[model samples]
Target: MNYFELHIGDYAEATQHLSILEDGVYSRLLRKYYASEKPLPADVAIVQRLIVAKSKEERAAVEAVLQEFFVLAEDGWHQLRCDGEIERYRSGEPERKAKKANEEERMKRHREERAELFTKLTAAGAHAPWNLPIKELRERVAALPAIVSGDEPATPATGPETLQVGEPATAPATPATATQTPIPNTHYPDTNTQTPTNIGINTPLPPKGGRKRSREPVEEPQGFVRFWAAWPASKRKESRGKCAEVWVREGFEALADVIVAHVEAKRDQTDWAHDGGQYVEAPMVYLNSRKWEGAEVGAMHQRKREVVI
Candidate 1:
């Protein structure tokens, strides 16, 4: 444990008998105890070393405090109050860890489920069903028939024509006398312009406007472009894609102004601008480390005052 509870009333009552020096020694010993998450050593010399006691008076203060607050046990010198607190902290750890684990798993499952739903909706050409209410979107998704690749819809079957009573059944007609003439092949000859007799029946016609020479370029998102323009440039530009991924993942869009403010504030700092921004970190590195998360507007103003003075 990095920390432990210190009730003011209990602390005052426990140390009322000790001098100021002894009280300081006691506090240092408690810190060492919690930091190690174990009891003090049984040997006074070992305790002195653990608490880094330097002088004869300091050692005496430590010894006096230890005797008053701690009892010799099988393991070491144990304080009843500290032991109780350790027990209470340990007893609740498993439940707290389990709760954290459960929450992480739930979030993972939700992201996966949402991604799957979004993919299905997009494939079906539904226009942004993800923006709809969860219940309604789910209902629409459920109403769609299961789609299987490489499968076509079934065609309706037609029944044979029936003859009236006492009417003779006619023989099958010849192809020449049939009501409709079947095209020679799948291709239909051009009737309007017939100069090209050498053209094969399977030859495809030229496109009306001609084939496009190149594909249109894909456009990047305007928000990301703006952010890139504002960020400080450096040689480490390769990680821009990764930095953008993290930004979108963490929802930095809502904090755009805050991030800009942090960047502008840091620009004038001694460490960042010491040698014409040579010491400044790359834009990608800054974004990846989430530097803006802890930046304080007030702290920046204070630093500005300090620099001026």
Candidate 2:
């Protein structure tokens, strides 16, 4: 086990009678026990080396702590409380892993279900719900049952109209034309007519005509779309708009490769994969937090090699 629970009250009660130095030594020994995931060495010299006890006072403290808290068992020197914690951790590990796996499987199924629904909606000619205004999307969804059932047509009739089956068609009579009356014409002067008086005033010629500066719509880049697709979905999925805004504002398009690489490298990390990925940040949150910007690619690789060595 890499970790063990240390209840403050229990710890204090156990070490209450020990001196401060003895308490420190006891704490160090407990850390070694958990870190090594085994019993401590029975030899005092080896134990001193493990706890880094050098000075005479420190050695004395170590001996006193061991006498008070540890037992010389058949295997080695063991702390009963530490042994109990280790037992609990070992016993619970399999159950914890099983639960995590089940949760991950459940989440995977949920994502597949959503993807299927999105495909169906798109095939039905409904605009992508993610791209539609929330109210409009809700209305479409509310009306989807009727549309799918064929009970209601896509377009409703405006008014009732019918054709008679047995009646013969009748021709309508034309109306008489009215006589025309002529009237005098009224003409208006053109606004651009020349002025009678010549004025010697210098006027700035109108700025040379040029093409209008029209701003084309900001299209979502393919890289961002790919990145979004690769990102694990979570409750913060709705924050995609905010994420896109940040991506544009920060000009993250050029760094898309870097972001993707960072995500790939960190995806399987304990922090990201823990709790069935519940700890993974939303795409927008991860980007806005600048997590991808600080990826230590070569450094991580070097550390991995060192660990293996």
Task: State candidate 2's TM-score.
Answer: 0.44
Q: What's every prediction's RMSD, in angstroms? A: 15.1, 18.6
Candidates' C-alpha lDDT: 0.65, 0.65
Residue pairs in clash, model 1: none
Question: What digit string (tens of lDDT, one per residue) describes model 2 on residues 1-309?
Answer: 656677888888877988888888988998899888789998888899888999999998888888888999877899888888788878998998998799768656644443344444444555342223334444554566666536678686743234367756655666555653333222222224323322113422223452232333456775577678767655656666667778888867655545655676677654775666777777877887878534433332233222110
Best by TM-score: 1
Q: Tell me the lDDT of model 1 at 176.
A: 66
Over the full model, what C-alpha lDDT does candidate 1 score relative to the true structure? Answer: 0.65
Model 2 pairs whose backbones collide = none
TM-score of each: 0.46, 0.44
Count clashing residue pairs per candidate.
Answer: 0, 0
